[model samples]
Target: MFSGNGHGKLVGSTQVDELGVLESPVVLTATLSVFRAADALLSWLMERRPDGVSFNPLVGETNDGHLSDIRRRPITEDHVLAAVAQASDGPPAEGCVGAGAGTTALGFKAGIGTSSRTVRTAGRTGTVGALVQSNFGGVLTVLGVPMPADELVPAADRTEPPGNSCMIVVATDLPVDARQLGRLARRAVFAMARVGASFSSTSGDYAIAFTTSDQPPIPDGEIDPVFAAVLDAVEEALLNSLFTAVTTTGVGGRTSHAVPHRAVIERLTAAGRLPAPPLIPESPSETRLRTTPARDEPGS
Candidate 1:
C-alpha cells in the first residue's frame, strides 16, 4: 500500500503495512461509515473462518458528506454482504455506483472508474488493472490538456467541498511479492497527477496493489514494463471516472454537475489531441483481445 497523504481513514492499513498481505476483500464506503463497514466486513470474513481466529477487515473510505447525508450513516451490513455476494468476474460497472454513488471530484460528479493494461517483460506477459474511487480536487486535465479556464460551471451546481480524497486499488496477474506490489502501488498513486489530482493536505490519496499469480516472482530488473502499464491504466481510469459520472444532487440540495463531454471533446479536437474515430468499430471483446499481449509472444 502507498499513501500520498494520510488525512483520511483506511482501516487495516497498519496491518497490511506491517505484514504486507491483505487477507480480506476491500470494502469502500463513506467516511463516517468506515468503522461500520469494517465491522461488517470482519463479520462476513469471520463466518468463513474458524472461531477465535481474528482477521483484518480491509475497508477504505472518502468523505462524501457534501453530496450525501453522511451523518445518517446510511451504509449497513446488508449492503456490504450484498456487494460481496454479487461480485463478478466480468468487467465492473463504473461511475456513480457502489461506494462512489454520492462522490464528487475535480469540480464534477465523480465516482468509480476502472481500466486495465497489458505488459510484456523479459519472456513473460501479464495484465495490470486499476479501480479508483476518484473524489479528489484539482484543476481538471485530460491527456495533459487542461480544461479551458473560460468554461463556466454554474455556481449552484459546483462542488465546493471542504476537503477531498481518493482510493485506488490495483491488481495484476504477474508474479510479484509484497515489496514489488508496494512499488506498483506507489506508481498508481503517482499516476493521479497525470489527471490533475492535487493530493491536498486534507486529501487521503492511497493505493493498494496486489497480484494473483502463483508463479515465481518476476525479477526486479524486469518490472519496468509493469510499472509503465500501471501509469497508463490508472490515468485512464481517473479520466473514466470523470467522463462517465452523471450529475447528482444531494444533501441540502447541493449539486455536482457532470463533466461537459461535448465541450471537452471540442477542446481536445481543437488542440489536435483527439484521435479520429476508427473507420470500423470493434466489439468490446475484440478490442480487449487486440489490446492484450499474447501470452506466448516470440520474445515472451
Candidate 2:
C-alpha cells in the first residue's frame, strides 16, 4: 500500500498527480505525477487572474533506483514546487538532482543531463532551457570518441542495468505552437543519440516542449515568431542539460560518474567549442589569503 502524500508533508494515499494546482508560475515533479503536479501547474497558470485558464504543463522524469528508494514514493508537493521555484534562468546544473534522482543509463549512473547551443537569427536572440530525466542505454562515446573494450561492460553482464526511461522538457520564451514544439521534441532524441544513447528497445524516450511567447489565441495563422523561438531554445536547452549535468551515483551501490565539469570545460576548450576559463589573480605582496576554519590535519 502506498503511504506518504499530504497530511504528513506527503499524503501516501495521494499519488503525485493529485497535487491539484499551483498558485504560482511553473512547477516540476518527476514521474508518477502525470496528473496532480501537471494539473496544479496548469492551474497556477491562472494565479494572477481569477478567470478560467488552460496550459499544457511541462514535466520530466528519469527512474531513480541506484540512489533513491523508488518504492517509497517520497516525492511531495514541496519537492515539486522546489524544483520549479529554484530553477534559475541560466544553465541548469545536472546529474542526480531534480528528475534524475534514481536513474541510470547504459547501466551507469544516469539521471537528468542538459545542454545548450547559442544561435543567432535575424537580429533578436533568446535563451532556451532544457530539463531531462536521463535513463537510457546505448554506449559511452562523446564527440566520436571511442569507448575502449577495456571499459566496456558487456550488455549481457549480470550487473548490467536495465533499459531505462527518460522524459525531456523543453521551454522557451520563443513564439511557437504545439506542432512546432512537437517537432523540436523529436529532434531532442538525436541530441541524446550523439551522447551515446541508442534509444534502447526497453526504454521510453518521450519529449515535450512549451513556449512563453505572448500572442493572441489564433484559430489559424501563417508565419509564427514564437514557433521559431521554440526551435532555437529547444536545441539549446538540450545542449545545456548535457552541459551542466555532472556525473552522479544513485541506489544499489552503483556509481554513476558525473561528467566531470572541469574536465568537460577543458575538452570543449580543446575542441575550440568554448573559450578558456579566466585565470585567477595572485595575491599582492602585501596581501595574504587564508583558509578560514582550517580543516583538521592529522599529526599536524
Candidate 3:
C-alpha cells in the first residue's frame, strides 16, 4: 500500500514518495541489472494496463561484482518475465538464490535471508516480515555475543575487505502511512548495525518498508511496538543470512566461506544466551482429541 526508503539504489522511489503508494511490482536484483528488470516490468505492466500511459516500477539493487561478472550485465527481460510468471505463495528459497546468488557479507558468503515477528497494537495483531540482501562488512555479532573474526572460515586473500552494500525490505500487515512506513524502514537499517554493518561510505545500505492491508492507520502514539518488531525481525533476518549461506566460489575463482554454525551455537550456549529447544511438532493423527480425558476414561 505504501513504502519508504532508507539509503541505496532504489529505482522509482520518487514516485512512491510523491504519490504515497506503490502502483507497481517491486523487483530486487544486482545493481547493474536493475534497469533491465525495471524495463521488463514496465513492459509487462503496460500490456496489463492497456489504458495506462505512465507507471513507476519499483526496483532495488546491491552490487554483486565481488562474486559475479557484473560487467557482463547478464540479467535479461526474459529472466524478469520468468520470475514474475513463476511467483508462488509459499516460503521463499533463501541463501544464495535470485538476486543474492553472488553476494558476500561480513567476510562470508551471504545472500537472501528472511524473518518475521508478530506484534499487537490496539488489541490487533499483525506480522512484520523482513528480507535482506546482506552484502556488507562489520565484526559479526550474534545475540550480543562477539564472534571473533579469526574463528570464521577463511576467505580467499583479497585486496579489499569483502562488502559492498545491503538491501533490506520490510513488509507488514499493520495499517500505516508512507511517513510511518519510512520510520519503520529506518529501524530496519538500524538493525544492520547490531549485526556489524559498517555502513561504509562505499556501501549502499537501504531499506524499503511497506504495508499490505487496508486497515485503518495506526495512531502515531501506538507505533512503538511496531518499531520494536521491525528491529527484531531485521536483526534476525541478517543473522539468518549468515547462518544459512554456504561457502561459495564465484567470479575469478574468488571464494567466500560460510559462517561456522556449530561454533556460534556453542558460544551462545556457553554464554547462557540460547533458549530452550522447542517441542517436537505433533503428527496429524496425534492431534485428534479423544471424547474423554485419560483420568476419566473407563480404561483408566
Candidate 4:
C-alpha cells in the first residue's frame, strides 16, 4: 500500500507459512532483495511470536533494471512497516510502483496488476485472486493475435532475450494446501501467456498461490478445493495489473508506455476481451468479508 520514496517502504513484501497450513500476508519486491526482505520479515514475526516456530517468508520479485535505482537498494524496515500498517483490502495499483516500478511486459511499461473472479460453491461466494509484478518479453502474441511491441521503449531487436520476470501471487479464502497452491501458481502461467508472455529459460515466470480456507488441525474427512480459485484468481489479478497501469518516464530518459488504455479498449473490444467498467479503482480502505465461491471472474 505504501509508495513513493517519501511515503512507502522500498523493501520486498514477505510471507511466512505456518507449517504449510497457514501463510502470512504476501510481500512483493525487487529481484535481488528477496532474501533480505524475507529475513527482515521473519525477524519482525519472531519478535511478535517468539515460539521458535518456523516461518519462511514467500518473497516474489521482478527485475527493475531500467527504471529503478538498483544500486541504492532503497527498501527498509520503515517502508515494510508502513506498507503493512497501511494495507487495505481493495484493488491494487499498476503501471509503475512497488515491485513493478521497474518492469516491462509485452514490450511496454508494466508493473503491478491484479484481478479477481467469483465462483459459486455450496450456495456461497468465493474470490480467486492474482497479483503480479509485471516484467515479460515484448513483441509476442496473446491468444494467437500478434501484438506489436511497445515502440516507445524499442529494443535493439526481437529474439534479443527474455530477461523479464514476474512474481505472480494468488490467494483465496478457500481451503487448500501448498501442493494445490503450487498447481494454481503454474496455472497462472496460462494467464501470463494470455498477456503475451512465453516461458523462456532465462525469464523467471514463477507463481505462488495460497488459500485461507483450510484451518489448523484440518480433519482427514475432507479438504477444501482451492485449485480453481487460485488459478482463476491469479489470471484475473494479472489482468488487473495491466488494466490499472498508466505510462511512466524515469531514469536514462527511458519511456515505458503503460498498457495503452485506448489500445486496450480497442483491441479487447474487437476481440471481445473487454470487461465491464474496464477497470476498478480502490479506495484508501476496503470492505472486509469472507465470501464463499463463485465463477466467471469480473475481469483480468
Candidate 1 vs candidate 2: the TM-score winner is: 1
The candidate, 1 or 4, that scores higher on TM-score is: 1
TM-score of each: 0.89, 0.59, 0.86, 0.72
> Taking the tens digit of each residue's C-alpha lDDT, what string does model 1 give over 77-119?
8888888989989998887787887888887778899999989
Better of 1 and 3 by lDDT: 1
Ranking by TM-score: 1, 3, 4, 2
Shift in Å, residue 19, candidate 3: 1.8
CA-lDDT, candidates in order: 0.81, 0.47, 0.77, 0.56
Expressed as tens digits, the lDDT of each residue in 224-257 for candidate 4 is 3344555556555665655455555544555555
Q: For residue 150, give model 3's deviation from the true position in Å.
A: 3.4
Q: In model 2, which runs have C-alpha deviations exceeding 4 angstroms?
A: 1-58, 148-160, 215-252, 258-300
* Residues 106-146, model 2: lDDT tens digits: 44444455644443433445455666666666654555453
lDDT measured at residue 171 in model 1 versus the true structure, 0 to 100: 97
Among these predictions, the greatest lDDT belongs to 1
lDDT tens per residue, model 3, 122-143: 7789999999988887778888
Q: What is candidate 4's TM-score against the reference?
A: 0.72
lDDT of 4: 0.56
